[model samples]
Target: MKRKVDNSYGIIPFYIPSEKIVEKSKGCYLYDSEGKQYTDFESGVWCANLGHSNDRIVKAMEAGIRQSIHHGYKFRNHPSEFLSQELVRITGLEKGSSVFLSSGSEAVNLAISMARNITRREKILKIHNSYLSAYGYGQITPGNNHIENVHFNDMQSLDETNFGEIAALVLETGGASIDMVRFPDYAFIQELVELSVANGCLVVADEVTTGMGRMGKWFGFQYYDFLPDIVVTGKALGNGYPVSAVTVSAKISESFGKNPFRHLQSHQNDPMGGVIGLEVIRTIGDENLLNRCLDTGHYFKERLLFLNAKFKQEIREVRGRGLMIALELDNSVNGELVSDLLFERGFVIGYKANTLRFLPPLVIEITEIDKLITNIGEILELLRQ
Candidate 1:
């Protein structure tokens, strides 16, 4: 097919050359230049928790842009102050403080830096399958020995005795977003937290993809009983406005006074981004989106269970919490093929390895959810033949 879109300048060629260019988005649907509407279940890479083009958020963003005098580097901004307080209140970290950044990568990097600084330890431990950005210690390139990777299922391998040498253990609160969304056991996570505490190691909860009511809570860490020393949040924090933050506990904040904690970026603490973030948080509350996500997630899972019962041979498993769900298919069913078929059927979902992932927007309706589930069943039936 002839294509009008240019791929020459694109850094990552994730899609084929003839891919449709999305012209606009509203709520949980995306419209291409050809005026074809696709039910966006991936939620624009899982950041649009409030859905695309939220009216209230758009208005707030416009006013913020118009009124924002400075980016708050040398001078202070009111939006930053308001956002910091909101973050503290929402996260239930009244004693903690936050630092705003531009991306999830930056937030993870800053949180790790703070952990290392406070604990004065060189070694850091993280889950093997967890995705914690690709920058600094989070980066998993070869020859990197400072960070140690431990399998979640195999906790015995993690050295829990190195109290003095280990700085922190970074964890993704819900599931790892790799080939498929693999949520670790709640009991296992709690045990790990207890182990870290016993060993005097700090805990850094990486909530990049799982925060902002994605898991039916303000932050994924809240789902667990324990509170992390450092909480890294991004993705949906500013909805589609490009903002992230690293919030530190009172103890870590106090430790900063003992030594210099240096980290800065050009877009760090920008008032415009702060305003957008605050608005996103407000919209989630005003719209009562958390309970909506919880209820919808339950309904979605039940539908998946019905599909599982009908297509037992093709489907392997269905798992995840809240709106962050996944369906694992047997080796015979190709994930990429399923994704392509869904796209052709006017639905947008994520295909990673052998799993079909769903992160539908919180504003998604029951009718749209029915459409997605019905389409999947039809596609799987056709592929079976």
Candidate 2:
């Protein structure tokens, strides 16, 4: 049967689909049109914090939709209003205001615009390897104009001294890794945040993967012990629903004053999605998932450390926070060989091809971590031989 062509039609299809298919996803599992079940550790590209079909998220969306699919922007909506308030409450950002978007790139664009408007500055500065937004055509159409990408580690240099012309410095706290994790030091990161603020450059944090307890903190900025002028989040906000948000402090949000367009995006403040986001927040708090991430993160972190010592000659580095971990292999190991070995052995681990990534579902069991460590260790040993 021929299927209708839609968005996601081009660019890159990492996994070729022999036939078009759809599936019912629940928890961390996807049951495809072919009726095969696959467990996903990527969590919808790290968006589904509470997993797919979370009871709270689903119920909230369903209830809101049954009442009204959307609340026109003119009339203030409860879900939107409450979710913003709740986020402000949890974030420690004084007088927090939120602008909703359907994707992370839009959130990034909004934050960038907010920075320029507030400071009355023009240039947008970014650090290298930061996933401040997606690389889709939608991003190219808008935020691509004045955006600047620089190396995150290139701070305290001649280039960084040129911030006089920049309005905001947006950073992705998590280091870059195609399939691996590359987190940096708390002190080093804190310096960047502080330096930007001191230099009259508003700091914008892209927490799309670090929010909703993914990184053992409610938000990644908390780990740095500093506040950003604005923070952008999307992936885990709705626990699987299409929702992203821009959170700002009172000082920063005040810049929105007299702006002709507020949330000008047509789909901003869609009620059903907002309700799901509120629920995602509630579930994270009620389940104490932040604590779980810290505990599990530490436990698994040790295993990676142990692996490094065990395979020092073959392991270049191991890094990450909480569930967003990565194992960087030394140049000696054939990354393709290790990736294929793990996949063939029934483990659905992900990789940057050159590095190994472990973004297992937050709900992963203790035994599974053991299994992953053991399987990886065996693979390493085999390679060494």
Candidate 3:
């Protein structure tokens, strides 16, 4: 069989597939062209909270297609309205506003634009590793809006001087922003928020990875004590359908009316994207999967801890929130090697550098997690031997 192209991201043969092709996928499992099945843990880049080929999402999208497929940007569509309104209800931001886009990077880029545009400030602060969509959005306009990196927990670096000239601070709620080596403390995040507010700056939380119950809450910021001036939600918002959204406080949104910050593309708020995303959110609340994520997070964390305790040297630490987990290895085996071994055993996972990220579908059964633990334990033991 022929192939359309490679992923262009890597030499691991990119989207060519180790096998012929992924014939079909469902729930938490995927079948390749050879009838071989593998458990999906990556969630198609950490976005498939509702899992693969969800019927409700699929049907909702089909219904949207049955209606108007595309419409003007200014005129509101039902799906976009439903999504923005539903997100507003969920986040409870007091008339919070939403701007739609089709990707995490785009959503984040627009967010930075909004912050600079509204606050009329010229500096942006980010931690050591930032996944806040501020990346590659041009070089901060050369001191017009300079960037300072605090390296995650260097919150002690959050004094008035360092944050000076800063209009907003952007952060990712999950482990992606700072790498698996270190994550920030919630207290520090709230502190930053309070400080920024007092000093006349906005706070932006990039919840693309940690939102939608992947982290046991609608938004990871909910776990923290305070609110941000702007919040960016993507990834699971469209469940792998390339849709993203930025929600801002009612106060900041007012700036747009005076000088509209035009963002979004032709496909930004596709009817299909909105309807499917809406159904996915509804399914999450309806099934109370949020609660399941919390319970299962505890259970999964306990099991992982047992492994960490068992192999104290190789396992540096087990960290992350809810269904998003990272197994930090201090050993020389390497994360990519471990991931490859697991893939050979019919488990698909990806890693960030040496840190292995495990983001299984929210609907993943506890038994499946156990199986993963068992496989990982046996492999690590063999490697040590």
Root-mean-square deviation of every model: 2.4, 4.3, 3.7
Better of 1 and 2 by lDDT: 1
When summed lDDT is taken over every stretch of 10 residues in candidate 1, the lowest stretch is 1-10
TM-score leaderboard ranking: 1, 3, 2
Model 1 regions more than 4 Å off: 1-6, 9-18, 159-164
lDDT of 2 by residue, 172-234 (tens): 777434324666567667666676777799888888777778888888778778878788888
Q: Candidate 2 has what TM-score? A: 0.86
What does candidate 3's lDDT look like per residue over 31-143, in tens digits?
88778888988887788888888888788877888897778676777788788888878877778778778777787778877888877876677765655554554233354
On TM-score, the leading prediction is 1
Query: Which residue pairs collide, candidate 2?
Result: 47-235, 128-150
| Alpha-carbon TM-score of each model against the true structure | 0.94, 0.86, 0.90
Model 1 pairs whose backbones collide: none
**lDDT, candidate 2, residue 158?**
25
Residue-level lDDT of model 1, residues 242-305, one tens digit each, is 8999887888888888978898788888898888988888889988989999999999989999
